[model samples]
Target: MHIKKAIERVPGGLMLIPLLLGACVHTFAPDAGKYFGSFTNGLMTGTVPILAVWFFCMGATINLKATGVVLKKSGTLVLTKILVAWVVAMIATRLLPPGGIQTGLFTGLSVLALVTAMDMTNGGLYAALMQQYGTQEEAGAFVLTSIESGPLVSMLILGATGVAVFEPRLFVGAVLPFLIGFALGNLDAELREFFGRCVHPLIPFFGFALGCSIDLGVIAKSGFTGVFVGLAVIVITGVPLILADKVIGGGNGTAGLAASSTAGAAVANPQIIGNMIPELKPMADSATAITATACLLTAILVPILTAMWARKYEMLRNKEQSAQAAPAQNPSSLAQDGHF
Candidate 1:
């Protein structure tokens, strides 16, 4: 118990431990990555057989009202994600030369794209902003929520490119489930209700997959470039989000902090990039190897930054609120005293 608590105090103890364990298994045993690869591979290969539930769940989780509001208000952020990612891709292509980053940059972009594309986890913050600012229903708050949920796009684009994502394989996995769901959804309301109930519960199985593979020691071996990239992505990817927010009128540190935050394995990008540009597999692999390291590092930083940003925003907000109210209250109170 004491040892576990002590470990927890170390930064990224949870991630660090699992990464280490995975590496230890991979290194000492040597065949571990292969075995782990096999599992992920098998999952990818067999995924098409069972993906319907996931898609259904994904569809259901997207609340219709929120999604519609998000679409109307957040069209720009969504467009921004695609455009910025494309620009980054194009620049990477130009600078890489000859081989021109067929792999490394492609690999890194896939990883960065995940962070760039997502904002779902910010729902609570969006709700809080809406409540405090009296603009929940306003276009601004909806746009904010839309921005926060950008990762969905990142995952989709990256996955489509073959980031060990179940995308193409997903069709394979989802076929049966889709057929079943399609048939059931059409024929009987009860079955539709059943699928509605059943689909989302399986989403957390993805969490199990996350928990199972995350061994700590792999991070220890990641080295300096890995750490540098984490910081770099935080700065590089985060700057755009901040810039976008400022231009659109939602530029708070909270959104950027959250925007740069990441989760799951980012190494998947290499495989995705390699698939997109097969000529650069070596670079892609190098990038993939490094990015997983960076992701774990950044994931640790996210919550700390978010908490810090929120506190700062709150302090500023409170100060502003007090400043605005004081003049109005003071005069009225003075008039009341005079009357008395």
Candidate 2:
């Protein structure tokens, strides 16, 4: 059974396939992890730890000499994504109800859901896609996008005031493992090679763990409204990301598309932020469901879109290159054919 080969045939399949499998386990046997106990349970609940190690491995793969490029690419994507979400938040305040829509087909839609889904790029998904379709620098771009892992960015974008504030330590904590690996990797080439090898191997582990957190039922419960929010997220965030990648990040816009996905972690942000703001608490459950659906939807779609865009970009680039080389390679033939 060409299982590995089969998975590779599907875009983002290394990640998405495991994620789906895990979601199935969660949906059908929610207590399977507990029932099995020990390591099995750990794998079921090890998303954060697995991702932490993966981040370290990913950082190890980066050479410090190329840090500047990575920083620029990551920074461009991160800032553009956040800025877009902030602008949406400002508009949503006027357009959406304070308590979210409570009637009709769009009853559960809310600004919290919109912003949460819009603000954070699924770093793991972006990195996995970029590693397959982009440059090493582009793959390293997830280094900074990790900042969007929690509810802080959403809270800030949504104008959470008073006690809600950025915690410097949380930001530090987010990148510390990567930083440590980066330092060690730079200091010793052997360490870099050893740790870097672990990056790709770890993808499915965290993917499964990430999937375990999601209940596939949520998407169905949220229905078409959830699907609409998911598509809205891709379009609304994706266009700007693509343009930013071309104009600023110096790529063919594939990285931006990869970064436009909603993080699986973003599903929890609604409730976390809502707990702080009482008015939003009522909508948190709805927001969580929509965000989860968006997470799953984007996870499946962004990789496919990025893959398509990358292939098209590569074809266009090759065509241009061939066009430029034609005059140099076939000047005599051209002159004879054209009588120039």
Where does model 1 exceed 4 Å of error?
A: 1-23, 32-60, 67-79, 97-222, 249-253, 272-277, 327-340
Q: What does the lDDT read for residue 237 in candidate 2?
A: 95
Candidate 2: pairs in clash: none
Kindly list the per-residue Cα lDDT of model 2 for residues 1-340, writing each as its tens digit. Answer: 9999998765456766787788789889999999999999999988767877877776676666658899999999999999998887778778877788877788688788889989999887898889999999999998777566556678677664222344566546656887788889889999999997897688788778766766776546666778898999899999999999999999989999999888766765775566566777778767877877787788889988989999998999999998988756477887989857
RMSD of each predicted structure: 7.7, 5.5
As a TM-score, model 1 comes out at 0.55
Off by over 4 Å in 2: 1-66, 160-221, 327-340
RMSD after Cα superposition, model 2: 5.5
